[model samples]
Target chain A: MEQKKVILIIDDDPDIRSALRVMLESAGFVVGEAANGEEGLKAVQRIQPDAVIIDLMMENVDSGSQVAIKLKEDKYPGPMYMLSSAGDAVRYNIDARELGLAGIFQKPVDPKVFISTLKAKLGVA
Target chain B: MADSSGKYSQSVLSKIIRFFLRDEEGSFPVFLHSLRLEDQLYDFTIVRFSVAFLIIAGSLFAKYILEISQLNHYALIILAIILFFANTINFLIAYPARKKKEKSSAYRFLLIFILHLSIATDFIFLTIALWLVGGVYSPFQTFFIFHVIIASVLFSPLISFAYTIYGYLLFLTLAIVSWKQWLPPIFPIGAVPSDAPPTGKYIITVAVVQGLLFFLTASLTTHLMYFLREGQRQIVRINKDLERLCDQRKGFLQIALHNLRAPISAIAMHLQNLLYGYGGELNDNQKSWVQRSLTRIDELISFLHDLENLSVMENADLLREANEFGLNDLIEKIIEENQDLILSKNHEIKIELPEGKIFILGIQRLIREAILNFLTNAIKYTPPNGKIIVRAYRYSSCVRVEVEDNGIGISKEDIPKLFREFVRLKNQKREGVDTTGSGLGLFIVRQVIESHGGKVFVKSEPGKGSIFGFELPIHIKK
Candidate 1:
């Protein structure tokens, strides 16, 4: 039997963290959650999940994106994705690919697309 | 278009004109000459020549009253004819100048040369006429004082000094040459008695005194104009500095407002997930509360959006990107955005646009935001099954856009307060309408329109429809 892949969700909003946890769990993957960027970094070190999803904005402005950079520098092997609800990605002139992000999802994330992308990132299929 | 060789010829022609007019010889005592002086110089010349005409005509009568020579009479007549021709040329130059407010320096210099040339030539002819009348003893020599004064007021001290030197040398030479018997005796009246004061002594004395006066007048007038010009330049610089500060502050405020949107957006997203059951099942009561919170959060987000828009509209950098875009395209987009709301209310929305596209130069995003505000207001106020109409048409030099609605109309007194920031009418929160609004909608609309050099107008009466619109200058396609 294969071990179920784990994913980490980093966001300041408790409701969003709980929602992501439930969605990922129902999709047959284990999920870990952190309330802020600081805790998110610690959680990534301890759990070393297959994929990481972080909010663009958290306790501090752009904290999530900054943490992703820090994680990449730390050589975290998990793929990172960015979630934002601050209008469009183009509005901020950010290219996820150039930032070492696997992808960006606008919230509220569509369940079908979010789950599928997560599966691809985890290579579950 | 003409190539470099053509431009080269143009520049060469300008140089020749400048040299002949002696314009390139003088540096201004102040920056006054750097400003557009074509109109000012032209007007001054017209007035000066007209006065010269009057002086010559008046002197003719004076000479006759005193019974002077017929030779003096012919000299005065010839001088008046030359001055009249100068005034006519001055008048012709004004036509092209009035048509084009900003002339190229070359064209302006040409016009300036023609004007100065006419006046300068008239002065020379007048001096000869004076010498021919009485050599050193011509009573009309007083006119030299007036010429020096006018020239000093209109041009730089150097030009005035040049004019003074030219007049003094020519007058002195005429007297000396006549005294030496090298030219005909310029005694238009009877010859001076042989016993009278020596003509050479009188001529030299008069020339020295007149030249001193010319130099004094030029120095004084130029100094006064210099002080006046420096004061004007200082005021212009201060005004520019203040405008720059305003733009900087607007930019800071816009960035802060956009930053505020990020957290609010995250809050709204979390609330939406809760309402949609992404975080497991919720009771009907819990779901209703979450939906209400989401609606309020959305309102805050929109208010921040309006604030960002207001700041951007005030930004000077954004104004430079204004480009020509179709009026019909903007109106159609606004209608399409509100299609759902329009259908929900069952409103009969009609669009009246020009036969073809009407192009106007503006920041498309700002203009679109303004029209959207008006459409949103119309949809918000109009009751179920009500009528809404959007119209765009050319109005003289501008394109007029209008949004009309048969909704709960505003009173006469309230109309004036409509565009004021954070102004929501008392009676606007009627039943069966989503009254949640930032109140900055109309204010933003007015700011955007006015920034584009346009005007906003509103017309309404209680229980009748409201008509809200703006007019923007049309862009004539190249």
Candidate 2:
């Protein structure tokens, strides 16, 4: 039996977390969900997922971005994905390519495209 | 009273005419000169024709009514011929000289003196003739009042007073001489004997009444004219003060906005670097958090920008510089620039613009900022795979641009305050979107549009789509 690839999803919206979880699970990967950046960080430490999907705006205001910075500074080896609203993407200078992010998706993400992009970034295709 | 050197000087007369026609250099002076000349020609023709008709009719009536022995018929005929010759010579000599030296002050004074002298001669002759016919009971004494009134209204008060004195003296001299039986026994009416002495008391009473009436009318008219001129001066002063205050307010606002720009720009740049991993390589979780912080910084900067614009709008004269541009091109550029965000959500943008160029006058940068704000808000509220349609068309006297989105529309309560600064819907708050925005986007948009003399309107229903539209005037320059 092969070990299933685990991915952590950090977002304040329940709909987004649930949708991401269903998409990753259906793509033959194990998924973990946290309602905030803090919870997401904890889940990352405990589950050590192969990749993480985070929202740019969430509780604690920029906690998700702070978590991403912390993980990178700590030399944590995992792919990161950022999800932002259209306004946020324009207002904030978030370049996924430059930030070592595998991809950045605007909400509400499509289940099929979300899964495909995640799989490709995680080398699970 | 008769100083030979004090007689009306030609130089003084020339100065007066020159004052009336000081400048012939500009278009206004030329127009005025032509108008004056036309008026003078019209007056001359009318006066000459009317006076000539009056003289001819008067002589014909005298010839038919009087008997050969009544009053001295031969002397009356001689006096009439002499008066007619004198008038003809004055008219012929004066008219040509007036035309040649119309703009000369000395000519104007001479013309006025000659007119007054002619009137004085007519009055003296008429008075002598009336005295010969009916002493103080002559009906022609009423005509003396006309001369008094004309002198008071047209001449300065000093000149009018002098004319009044001269008239009183003349009346007194005629009355005394006729009463003493020193003048000829001339009478036209059979009712009055030629030996009857003129009534001194009646003549003096008439002169006093005429002088009083002339002074009263002249003084009252001058007072009214002065009052109106002063009122106009006060109104002009008030308008100048208001303009000065408005200019000062604009100057202060410009200085304040210029000072705020540097600080806001610095903050935004620093935040941008942090979000982009200029500090260090961000792990999966760190990158997401930093990006969130950058959004909040951007929001704050946008709010500052709005405040600066609102200040600019206070001074109407310092409004944004407008230039003509193609509306379609501007919209296309904004859409293309934000393509990544639209693509990320799988949202489709549909642009429905007129086929030809929709030329509009606006500040390109401000218009772009306003449109970008609208598009961002549309995409922010819309759900995944939602559609945004931007339409542009020319309305009467204005151009209308609308952005419609089929997304989670604004609630009824939030719609009213959607354009207010720092006002975000409760739902956006519930989503834990803690972007550092000062929430001044819509407010800025409204201010910018209004500064251009345009208007912005929004329509939204919760759970339905939202439509935002703005109209700009077609001709904004003037």
Candidate 3:
């Protein structure tokens, strides 16, 4: 029996998280959820998911990139992606590759493309 | 510009000039570069005070420290005391006015009057001191150049020239008259080498040469003042224009960002639900809802397209894919894309093109958008079932495209304002017309056409119709 690939989702908007959860679940991946960057950090520690998808979630404790940097410093061995709502992720001026992000997925991500990108980066089916 | 310490001084100075100098409104900061009248007065006041104090210290230093005979320490000391007392009394009155926030108009009038009197008195005392020291041969006569320079910085060129002449006349009268055998002068001032009586020709020649030098000083300083004032005014004007442009850019971005973010997010949630089969396979009702959402998304995409087109033209960016392309082909493609809207509105759009392929050299991206803007504008402004005639033809070296509609036309007064950013005509609304224009379309068209060294044309009668379009040169200058 094969084990399910676990993906963590971090977003302040409940609707966005639930919508993403349904898509990922349908794609045969277990989805973990957190409301903000702090909970996301704790979730990363607890769940140890294979891949992490975080929202921009501005006007909260720390921005999306700050959480990514902290998780990397904490030695969270997982591929990370940012789901940005502000048109695109490049506007933040954050270097995705340097920040150890596999890629940036613009908000309202197409499920097929999102899953495929994750599969390619994680080297999974 | 009005600092806290100098606020009172400025208000008073401006008030005085407003009341007294009728021509001040026409030309301001007339002498000093950017200094207000009050700031210039303060500078003049400080310089006058320092000079008076320096004269007293300088005479005392020379009389006691160096101790040269025939120095006439008695006369110089008396002149220095008079200058010092006169300046001190004026300073006492002006100093309180400079500090006080609310001064009466009468007091302000007095302070302004005192400043003029102070400058006038400086000339008399300095001239006397110069005569006592050595008359025409006085080394301290060099200070007269500074006097002329200050006058030029404060007054107009003609007045400064007159003041320079006054200085020379004083020198000739005092030094030349007292030395005459026939003149009953109380005391006589002399040349540097007074052992032998100097020739009258030598004295007259020195006075003439000194007068020319004073005139030169006045002319040069006034010239410098004119250039400085002009340059400062230019910088201030440029700064105001830059601020206005920045404000316009800020407003544009706010509108663009708000329009992009909200609807896209709303559409995205529904799209993910329908496309990914969030719960299960959708029924017919759910399918119709999804279809409507998709249509909304299409509208959003077109709006985003317009935004991107306007922004690129705003930046005047040259597209990297720019190459020779057919103008007729671009227009035909745009019409085809908008065919559905035209048919639905029942607008009969007739396009007239040149016989063969008319090619133009430039970025196709902006030109395509510009023509699309024209076609769409004509379609929207005209009533349902109206005639929209689009013509593209050769005019010597240029290609002209016109979108003529016998629908609602612009008024004569409003025609000039048609191509400006965010301009909606007063009478643009009509039955069965899409009056919801972003108002940026024609502005973008004008920018694109003019940037190619081409021109836009509009001819209209309010009740009859309007012809709106642009001409682009085949060989565009890079």
Candidate 4:
């Protein structure tokens, strides 16, 4: 049996995390969730998921950037996808390509497109 | 009711004090006093005190001189003391009198006329003293022109002429009295001057000189006053126009900001859900489309942010908390952060920064926004293979930052309004570049610079490229 690909969803909004978990699970990937950057960092350390999706503006403001920066510095070998609101684009000074990002998913994420993007980035197709 | 009455009484007391303190040359006292019973009482008290002071001073000076006057010495002394006492009694009686009257133009005219009358009386007395002593040869007559000049300055020609006529009449009366020997020849101390002219010629010469002085002084003063008044009127009109323009600008900004909020919020909300996967799973093609949507949303968000900043700046409440930061560090951070966008556009960003440390005092967030806005515009406008140069140098008292682009430059006509909100350059409009700009980038840039007591200047011409530069006061700290 092929092992299930694990995906971590880090977002301060519970609704977002839950919705993303449903979409990723339905797409045939194992999913984990964390409500903040700190929790997300710990989850990444424990699970070392195949892919990580993080929200740019979280509880502490720029929490997702902090997580991404940490993951990059620590040489986390997985594709990182950033989920951000339109407002966060300028606020977090986010440049997806420069940050070694697989892609950026702006908020109100289209479930069909996001799951497919995750599947592609994670090589789950 | 009692509280209001108490306040009213206090107000009355204050008015009375002001009435006494103010210069009383015009019907200002009568006009002010007529409004309320209390003010009238105050005015009367002030007038009585003034009259008393004059009478006492006059009597003392008269007693010391002119010992052999025709009038009885005892009668003059008695009359002066009586007048002084009468003034004091009137002042005491008027303090509580409460018969308020409406302000009337008659009162204003009378007050002004009385002021002129008193001045005329003073001139008459001086002329009489001069005529009694030796007429035209009197040193006092030489200074009589000074009084005419002063009258011309303070009063209108009509008033001055009226006073002059009164002066002449008093002089004539005194001359007649001296001629008939009814008044003593209070001249020469003991021996009349041997060169003394006949009294008629002396009087005529004095009258002629005074009349000429009065007319000349009056005309010159009138012209001078008219010129000053006209200049003051022009200044007042200009200030009024500036105030109206400022008010209109404020109104425009208010409406613009209010109109922009709804669309920006809608875009943000929709973009939020799409980025968070709220709908359903997607394919690779769908993923690309969603990403494009996200980029569009980002552009709109940036535009709205610029609009908000411009509104804040217009209100003069753009609060900036200053911190010391290195210019090169910030520029590098921006470049490092925006490398992907630059690469995607197939453009190059060249940096020519000073090696030495250049520190500036600014809010870190605002400076970052301003620089990022400039860089974004540079990238957006520059064509593929275009170049952007971000340069910084230390000039006297300031640090200059220049962002030069070898892209389409603004036309000369549009340069003047380049830093105004919602003002796109004519060239940019003609080039038909689908720039997702708020047309507020340079506006915000100028505002931020001005708040720092600095300035932003742009040099651009059609097709020649443009250099947007700003200078900030250098901060030695850090």
Estimate, for each residue in B125-153, the C-alpha lDDT of model 4 and write its tens digit: 45654554444444455445555654555
- lDDT by residue for model 1 over B1-478, one digit each (tens)? 1243233235666556444432332321222243556656555565656666785776566576655453556656767776777677776775467567768889878877875776587577767766566656666776776776666666776887787777667666766776675765555454222323236677677768776876776677767766867797998899999999987887777677656765565566567566657777899999999879877876776676676666655553445777888889778765753454466567899999998788988777678778877887888788878899999988998999999998889998899898989987786666656677788889988887887889899999778889999999988899
lDDT over C-alpha atoms for residue B350 of model 1: 97
lDDT of each: 0.72, 0.64, 0.70, 0.66
Candidate 2, which segments miss by more than 4 Å at Cα?
A1-125, B1-242, B272-299, B311-323, B337-347, B361-370, B380-386, B394-398, B411-456, B472-478
lDDT by residue (tens digit), candidate 2, B1-478: 2444334345866556445543434222221112243333333333444455554555445656644235554444555566666677666655576447345777666666666766577667656655644444445555555555545544556776666666656665655566665776455554354444455675567556655654565455445534654675787789899889877876776566545544444444444444444456678787687667657655655565556545533432324455787788888766754566566567899999988777777666567768877887787777778899988888998889899998777787778897776775676542422323456778878877886878899998877789998999875443
Displacement of the residue B285 alpha carbon in candidate 1, Å: 11
State the DockQ, from 0 to 1, for candidate 3.
0.13
TM-score-wise, the better of 1 and 3 is 1
lDDT of 4 at B463: 74
Candidate 1 positional error at B299, Å:
6.1
Using TM-score as the measure, the top candidate is 1
lDDT of 3 by residue, B132-249 (tens): 7665566677777778887788777887887788776776675585455233322223224453333588677877887788889999999997787678789899999999998799
Model 1's CAPRI class is incorrect
Worst 10 residues of 3 chain B by lDDT: B182-191
Cα lDDT for residue B451, model 3?
Answer: 72
TM-score for chain A in each prediction: 0.93, 0.89, 0.90, 0.93
Q: What lDDT does candidate 1 reach at residue B149?
A: 65
Q: In model 3, where do residues sit more than 4 Å from their true spots? A: A1-125, B1-34, B89-115, B181-191, B195-199, B268-478
